[model samples]
Target chain A: MSESYEATVTDPVSAPMTCDSNPVEEWLRMDRMPHIWCPGCGIGTSVNCFTRAIEESSLDRKNIAIVSGIGCTGRVAGYLLLDSFHTTHGRALPFATGLKLASPKTKVVVYSGDGDLFAIGGNHFIHAARRNLDMTVLCVNNFNYGMTGGQVAPTTPEFAIASTTPYGSVERPFNLPYLAQSCGAVYVARWTVYHVKQLQRSIREALEKPGFTFIEMVAPCPTLFVRRNRLGDGLAALESYEENAVIKNGADTRECDLGMGGPIVCGKFVDIDRPSYLSNQVAHLRKVLGDRYVMPDAWQGVVQ
Target chain B: MNADPRGVLTGSHFLDGDHAAAEGALAAGANFSAGYPITPSTEVVERLAGRFPFTGGTFIQMEDELAASIAIQGAVWGGSKALTVTSGPGFSLMMEHLGYGIMTETPFVLVDVQRGGPSTGLPTMPAQADMMQARWGSHGDYEIIALAPSSPQECFNLMIRAFNLSEKYRTPVLLMMDECVGHMLERVVIPSPEKIQIEPRRYTRKGPDEQYWPYSLEECNNGDLVPPLTKVGEGHFPHITGLTHDDRGYPAMNAKSQAVLLGRLVDKIRNNADDIITIEEDGTDDADVIVVSYGITARVCQPAISRARAEGHKVGFLRLVTVWPFPEKRIRELAGRVSAFVVPEMNLGQIVREVERCSQGRPKVRGVTHAGGAVHDPEEIYNAIREVMG
Candidate 1:
């Protein structure tokens, strides 16, 4: 609706377009676009899938809140037409935890990047999972700190070239799915940006499930990660994913690690039910206090 | 508004400063507290953990102080009155989130039970070293309000005041209690809920269809600079960020935006210093010398001031109940009248600098500084007062 956005869409040389509506426009802050993402960056694609998943889920759109930390993918919260919080670096998980606990019925999602979540926010991630807090954690693993111009990250593949790791990364990358499962995440999944439909479906499934749900979207940083590592462009990265990616449901998360230029194992590796943090707290309190037990006002409507 | 009766204990009980503070927070309608355990401050959360179950509240022991600090801010946005308690080292970890809370204008209480520090100096001993840190620890040009309580009763009374002030201003308030005050057991009377005054959260009345901006000047009342808050999950769909932002709460990323945002953040407390400041004074009407102190040092200065007064030295006592605004006006007024001002604190002269700055070289200002691990000796403070008089 802004003049700048309209200016971008109207090209005098192009054929007259008849399409009047975009399906995702209803879920986006159209006025804020022209976003800052570089061309061929897969963060936009991942966001599209996420918005589609939210549309397909049973959650009330007004009741859904999204929180993000400092990164390129962290901008997703700002773009979304929902209650959004752009918090400090590596602090989104704990912020979302407070939001979810304070308003139990509200569906909270923490969306950030690998460097922001795994590298700096790893402690929060593990603790949030271990407590089985009810929230969805969607991480875009671009293998480098894209916003900070391609510094080395925790999800960066071993022996991969980066701004910091010019010779090669000597440290091992985290198998995120395995870490999520080990930390008691009830639902864990990973999908590349190339697998749009599958990623959308996985997100929808995670949104519906209870307890700590984590999905890692292995996106391409065309300007930074791909360029520095000689991995061609974003299109080439997608093409490589098409050729080397294996979709194996119920795969062992520990074996899903990716080496440089290796096969990317992607699937929903963990899905089991467990009592969430609030439920467990309520149950324990009810047993101890008997008739004196009172559910917190925030949890009253949902828990009873 | 009167507090909720369910949270009020409604009777007299012997309590430590920490327990009294916990009771005060609950009575002030703090239904959520996320804190990591640290020395001296651990008792506050331990009491909340035991009491929140019956009071229909939630207390989460977070993984660390960093998580605990920001988690409380999230809870505030989620439509809950919240707080987080910590000691010296943990308070250091919370500095970043304190800035975050200030930038977003999130109303919450951060109770810092002060202990020895620089880096974990003495976890079990008292120190007022964090006085400067409480005011300027966060990175940026912003202002915050801090209170110091010297007794269990003040802890109970001032914790409620702290939350009220936070809600009134829509900013984080610090209850700065040293280890001496936090662990000292004393008589505290929990008044009935109706007797306790509480400031309910200032929630915006705007509906979804209305044009509501979270940080707009339109949202703030004339002369009262705090904008009303909108709860998350409601229809407002507020976009809050730590970046220098416009009235709409979106990042503006420019100097003009930074000036506009930072100006209000600083002015809200500085302009309203008179309404926010609280000080207890005795016999300053005809005194040549004034002894200024806060926290545990204020209690220690009592006997010293009495001894000086008994000798006809005309020494007066001034206790800083609200320390952050520094009671500048009173200091300026008394600075012109008094010949000297003596400040006794557990730190190596943190607040004495403020006193000297406010005095503006008119009065001779002296700091009776002490390192942590113990309270200042009364004789030392008396000697400083006598020397300042000379």
Candidate 2:
């Protein structure tokens, strides 16, 4: 507790945020600001849209919990003034699933980057969706590992350049919308960071929806992915990025896969009602135990 | 805090070490468990799944050891006392999250029902091989509390101690039960809820208006108990990460910061070793040879010590209940008094090394070895004692 080893905080974030008139400021830890994100990074835009969605959502503010894995998108947990867990890399979903199961009423969200979700934690993603868990997963697909120097990602387009794939990636990218839909997500949506209003509205809608909602935000990693691929930086990348993106609300999830320099289909592809893991588990137990089965009051019977 | 009556079966029951451990967790006020079924540890989960529906407890069958381990951490931060059970292979998988939980300072219990293995050596058989693994398996220099039970009764009793230690320290407490002890059945007495004491998580006193730091200990009035824990839903906006962090729990990237962070992590356990370290000794006075053992091996040492005593060779028994702090000071004192220390274990040698290290070449230390398919023969242990005495 002494001042024995206080390191000179080289990048002590700008002066502590004072009482502010800004609404986003009310919901964010602005002192933790001047964030680690590069100047033209699309991650900050995605965070802006998310904070706006939280502001506009009808749910109680006290019931929200945010979880994030390791990456640029993962820092959202640190920025948000909500109950957040900055869990280990590729583990945000499982950790979020545990929180949702234990505190069923709390709305949990897993916000992370493409590599953290689809590469190391893809198995957990499929199983959580398959179970129809009552939570939302916001995957920011930046097409490369922004935190660990722009390595190629599962969502990176084939023939695109990355630090690991200096000569161009030779692998197929996972079409997230199709992946979420096929994995049994109750609601699936996608939008680029450029679509501010639409993206925020889509997040709000997903937040309202139940059972494994997934929203993939195609953000630009201007510092890493953009520079390495010779794509224009800052807003220039957003103006011309994923240019083939087409709005398709009800396209077949299979055909919605993103290909190299091909049409990028994005929309609220799947929205349907399905009982979540907790609800179904409760119902099944009730039917079997009848009056013997007692439902635990909130936060009583934590998930196994 | 007292045990929840709904979860406690307050009566004597004949139960195996694994089942006793499950009951112990319930009586210790653990409301949540996430685990993958593995041999020797499966009964702990199976018992909980069937019992939780009726006892207001929740048991989640996780996909793998990786999920099972981290899931418990989430539950803990969500204001629940949680734990996960696994054996050798699964315990190996849990190593990473064990480190994760330590770095984040999340309190939880993990029962590693020890089985023989460098890699899946024996599935159903017992091994005390994980003693070293429990101490150092997880990468990094953080400390953990571990317990070894010699019987089903101790399995139930020590489980509460394990949970209490974990709650008190905000560290992962390992109940290192070997396969033999986990499977062997015996009479276990469950006390009434009021009779069983449980450690409630210490919550910070600083109000919401005050800037709360998760690791700030300027107000830590007690040394045994670390900083008070703030739950995730408590609106503290508490940010915890696995990265080397400051007292605010914010990740810091420099070694000077890392040095301070790592120092606290290590010292929290090291400084409180006196209160955390526990060992049981019997018949040590005027003894020429003392046998050190734990888990089922401790029970196995009973006959060996008795045989040595019958032959008029002064023999003693030293049982390890809390293994992580290693009880080095106690071993050092005994080494100067006893002529030799004989250790018999299911593995070729694991904890015997600790005995050797603590002995400091002061006394002859010998080990009775086995490949772990079966328990050590009492006759072989008796011979080892005689040999060490000579």
Clash pairs, candidate 2, are A304-B59, A304-B60
Lowest lDDT block of 10, candidate 2 chain A: A1-10
Error of 2 at A21 (Å): 8.1
Candidate 2 — which residues are off by over 4 angstroms? A1-23, A299-304, B206-210, B222-225
Question: Which portions of model 1 show Cα errors greater than 4 Å?
Answer: A1-21
Measured against the true structure, the TM-scores of the candidates, in listed sequence, are: 0.97, 0.94
| Residue A119 local lDDT, model 1 | 82
Task: For residues A1-304, write the lDDT of model 2, one tens digit per residue.
Answer: 2231122112235646566566678788777766898767888888889989988999777678899998888888988888778998888888887777678878999999999999988988998899898899999998999999999999889899988898999898998988998889999988888888889999999998878999999888877888677666656677765466798887788887765557778788999898788878887887887777655545444432
lDDT per residue (tens digit) for residues A83-150 in model 1: 99999999999999999989988999999999999888999999999999899999999999988889
The superposed Cα distance between candidate 1 and the true structure at residue A276, in angstroms, equals 1.4
Best by DockQ: 1
The weakest ten consecutive residues by lDDT in model 1 chain A span A4-13
Clashing pairs in 1: none
